[model samples]
Target: MPDSHLHEPRDSTLVDLHQDLPDAARLKRLGVVIAVGAVIIAGAGIAWRSHSVGTETVTAHAAAVSDVAVVHPAPAAPTDDLVLPGQVQAWNSAAINARTNGYVRSWLADIGDHVHTGQPLAVLDAPEVDQALAQAEADYQTALANRSLAATTATRWTQLLTQDAVSKQETDEKQGDLAAKTAVANAALANVKRLRAMQGFERVLAPFDGVVTARAAQIGALVVTGNLNAQPLFTVADVHRMRIYVHVPQTYSAMLHPGIVASLDLPEYPGRTFSATLVRTAGAVDVQSGSVLVELQSDNTDRQLKPGAFTQVHFHAAGSVGTMTLPGTAILYGNDGPSIAVVGADGKVTVRLVKIIRDDGNVVRVTGALNTGDAVIDSPPDAIHNGQNVHVTQVLPAVTAAKAGARAK
Candidate 1:
């Protein structure tokens, strides 16, 4: 046996080394497992972060969209009555002005007095006209005397010429003098006639059978003739019938004819309607107002209706088929003219151009590519445009909106 202790130590050392080798292999496998777990956790964290960022971006975009309320267009009523404000006037009105210049001596007719045709309304004390007439008569008589003397002289001269006592030239001269005197007499007579006519105008007369509605002439008031700025002496109006002037819109101008009958409502007589007959129309639409002026006549035998009174006119206006009406606020005015914002089922906006038929402040009548069930934005934003995405906050019914518009009216 060669060194038993040394051999034992070497064998122990070898066994220990073998056991450590297995431990080292286990440790290496453990490190590999740890590294794989770390890589998987990092990947999960990064994916979760990216998903959270995407969700935030989507929420921000949704919050930025505009919200709006929508309403549906309502069907226009058929056979709708058109009511408009009208003015009441007299059938025949005249402003009685003085024909000649004079002082008003006396007034025979006062305001509210009914006078007949050619009735004297006032008498004027025109001293100047009287003096002129007297002078004209005196001049006319002087001219007549001169004409008589010239005629006698001419007859005497003709006799002398026949006997050769005077030359033919003398006889011709006498005849020419007579002719000149006759012309002067005729001129004076014409002047006298003119002055007499002026004298006849001393009494202001009524032009027709009517009631005196105004009296501007007072006793001793001096009147002037041919003056445009002068006020009339009296205002006479025929009250047997009344005239009503109504401005019918161009849309309803076709329905207004001469034989059409309408009703009038006066605030003075509540609940009472006066029957009126359409007498005439302007025949053309007024450019400024886009309406036709119509004249209607109403019998005022009882004299209940007065001139210059405000009244309401009502007509049975014919309605057009397939007409649509919407709230006036829904109309959008842009460079392309009038349009409306329509929302589709996908919440996308499609701006459709429209033609405005009428606007009654609360409601508007239009014709365009629109339906009864299509949603229209009410009071759309100015920036709202075509292809815009909008979130609808409320949807109003067509009937309810119509009733509301009617109430607003």
Candidate 2:
């Protein structure tokens, strides 16, 4: 009955309102759920990205660096060598001192005077020594006379005792006296010789063929002998050969021996270099300086080398084989470890750990899984990473001596 009465309702109203009611209500609920779910999902995504390690992150600036050329290690064959900071010195420096105390009567030579081995340098008025020698000689003469007399007397007494003219006891006494006189004579003669020998000490003679570098003695001056603490009156150095002393680093002490070849340079002569051979060394390193002292000698018959001049030395080490050298910039030293960034055949970057042997300012010597022909990145920036695709460009600038000097500075 109600359905029949619905005929009274408008047919257009029933059709329109009923058809849209169910769909409109369902669509409203669905929109609200979708909005809430979208916001929750977005918050979770932000949290996840923040804690993950593989996510994008930014870093600060890294240390600035330079690149160096790589070369091979030194071979084990003998090669020319050198050292730094050497000194030019005399082969033999002799300080002539007064052997006896006396007044200087006259000086025969002064500084810079060329002298022979036995050339007289100075003269002393040692009359006291001469007088002592004379007195000793007189005493020795008297002793000899007495000894001769005693010998004759002893011989006469022995003959008299054999003939029973003198008593045995008396002959024994004479024999003893003779022997005593002979001993006294011999001692007196020895004293005379010693005093005579000292007479020549008044004259100072050159110890060897050299130059007189000093003159402290003057006429009428009193000098003392064996005063080691005082300065010498004359200094003589052998000019034929020169000694170059250098303080080698202690780390290289073990590598040096008595005989080794090296090159030497003097500051006075910038372009001239002389051949120097290692003569001797301290054989041990100093605890304080971490260095060893080495002595070298060079032939200077032409008088080319001079003493008291500063010089440089270059030492050749034995068994030095070279290695493939690269610029120091290629080595990336960090708290993590020592590593290098290498480019693969596929144009990709692969960082590897390596061992560095030596670092010469311009080049860093290293050994690893690198080949000689491999392309290395010079002066790489810190932004590079492992497994990165990179384009390599070989950049080499013509370096001058001035530029090298700046880098060294």
Candidate 3:
């Protein structure tokens, strides 16, 4: 009421109020737009950072798992020995039989008795031979007496013919009779000599220095003159040296030769080994066994080893020739022959063909286009193929791999 001018007009007051309301509303809308823009920008930056980190982590993991473990091929070494089965036999063997027919005589030598050449083994008493010799001697004496009488008669007949006391025809007849008697005496002497020779064979003798392995002679056993269809009186074997017969497979035939040194193992003497030498070969392949018959001579001076016994022969072959060796686990058998997995310098896998020279149950000797430094894969995964990338984990020594192969069995 005191200041009517200060109160102002109502329309002016209303206009000011409306302008203030519009300004307030515009300020609120601007604040909302700024807040929305900030939220969108923050979300975009977080999403970009997460994507980059995930991509980097994925790339690192792929690179780390790309390599495979591998091993180097073992170099071939010398001094490898091979063991094979063999049979032992006597170096020299013989069967002694009776030469003349007679009753069984007492044997001087028995089984396990050592005898020298021409030593008496047995003596046979032949009653029939004695009687035959007596008869032949008597006939020879009678023939000798007749020949003497005929000679005297022929001399008298010749003298009479000279004195003309008898005819020429009669003298000729006397001479013919004397000649016939002389021929009879010569035949009788020959028969006596033949009988004497047969009598000398009653004593059976040893043919060589050896031990008697068998004895069939007895006090009452009958002895046969001929060897046909007759059992031997004694079996002798010269065991100073033993013969080892080994039927080596054809694959190892080339390693056998005269003078090759070897060792023998016998079941009778466990842990004992005897020295031997490869003496000879059968020179031909056995069609049935597809093997070569090799003869090895071993010294048996102590007579501890016997013939027909089984033995194992050890043969030392050139390890250098057989050289490259690998674990059996690394080998693969196929129609193209044996193969192995080898890794190249480029971190890729390669399949290589190899020849197995010898198989010693656990490890095998191989010959191939691989070097000693070649990195070979051990226990390769079936999923691995040629030219596949691998990560090298460990390289094992050849000896270690060989041991592993044995354990795998």
Candidate 4:
């Protein structure tokens, strides 16, 4: 221990002597340099420690943060309406036609002309019918003259028979002649009446009260009987009311019943609707389309609704009692099937499957394992998964022109 202490002192002594004389001035300058060097070393260590602490703080802050879309929960009870589109048509329609074979001498009506029942629609020039009538009339006249002469001769013969001037056979012959003449006269009268009735076919009359919607024949044009090469001279439609026919998908066929209330809409009158009533069904389903034909009736007393105009029909079905409606914009279309994200209480995202009953244009009615006030991501996420950990913030309402606004308020 003493030797160790002596070695330490000898080093001190050499240092003290070196610091004392001749080199004292040099020692003073050296002392100042050594103090300054110590100061620079201490400052460097302090600065390095401060810089390290700052770097650690910045890293911790970055790790705690993330950029994500946020959303809020909705109520469990949902009540949304479902809407669908449809078209309109006429209730009663018929193609007015010519019943007799003749030429159209004059058209008394045109398109949009409203006519009453039995109104003369057109005049037909039946030259052949006229000639036939003339022949029949001349034959009737000759028959009448012959019948008159036979009756006078039979009267004279009967008087002679009463005086026993003629035999029984002769008398019988005279009586037969009178009877034959009377039958001929009666036949002539029948013939004349039949000919007159046939001539009446030259006039075209409206079967019912309606507007003429089509005109195919002009004056001097040949019109044929039956549905042959000759088309109908005109098409008449009763525009006082209209019918809307729709082919509803077979899935909804069961829900439909006759006499159900419905509505009609025209694109020309956006956002407006006309009430209608379900009259009947086509009774059979279409094989190719898998749809059922539904007929609805509408009143058009003002004549505002025209036949052949395309219009939409809204079938007011009996909505589910406790159903909920969701904005379609919030529903996400995905590859594995449709799904929506729900942020759990633990800040983790969980996806859920939904059953869609009907898909209209804007809103949808759905049934799923979700409730009101449950924050669900409006749109499906990209590369996002079910049961994933997440940090959620309130996001803007989907498809709305708004910044982040609290929906709870």
Best by TM-score: 1
Candidate models: Cα lDDT each:
0.87, 0.73, 0.82, 0.71
The full ranking of all candidates by TM-score, starting with the best, is 1, 2, 3, 4
Report the C-alpha lDDT of model 4 over 178-289, residue by residue, as the tens digit.
Answer: 7887798788779778767657868878878889999887999887787666678888888888888888876567557798788777877788778888889987889998
Report the C-alpha displacement of residue 160, candidate 4, in angstroms.
7.7
User: Which scores higher on lDDT, 2 or 4?
Assistant: 2
Task: Name model 2 segments beyond 4 Å from true.
Answer: 1-83, 251-261, 316-319, 324-406
In candidate 1, what are the lDDT values of residues 295-334, reduced to their tens digit? 9999999998888899999876555566688888899999
lDDT of 2 at 26: 67
| Predicted candidate 3 versus true structure: per-residue lDDT over 136-229, tens digit per residue | 9999999999999999999999999999999999999889999999999999999999888778778888989999999988987888666688
TM-score (C-alpha, index-matched) for candidate 1: 0.72
| C-alpha TM-score for every candidate | 0.72, 0.66, 0.63, 0.55
lDDT accuracy of residue 94 in candidate 2:
88
- lDDT by residue for model 2 (1-409), tens: 3678556656553334334567778688678889999999999998898866344343211111223232222222234243568788887888888777788889999888889998999998787888999999999999999999999999999999889999999999999999999999999999998987788888899999987777888788778777767778788888888888888875456567878888877766788888888888887777898888999889998887766778878887552244345666677877776667777667666776766654445655556767655656666566767766665545354332234337888
Between candidates 1 and 3, the one scoring higher on lDDT is 1
lDDT of 1: 0.87
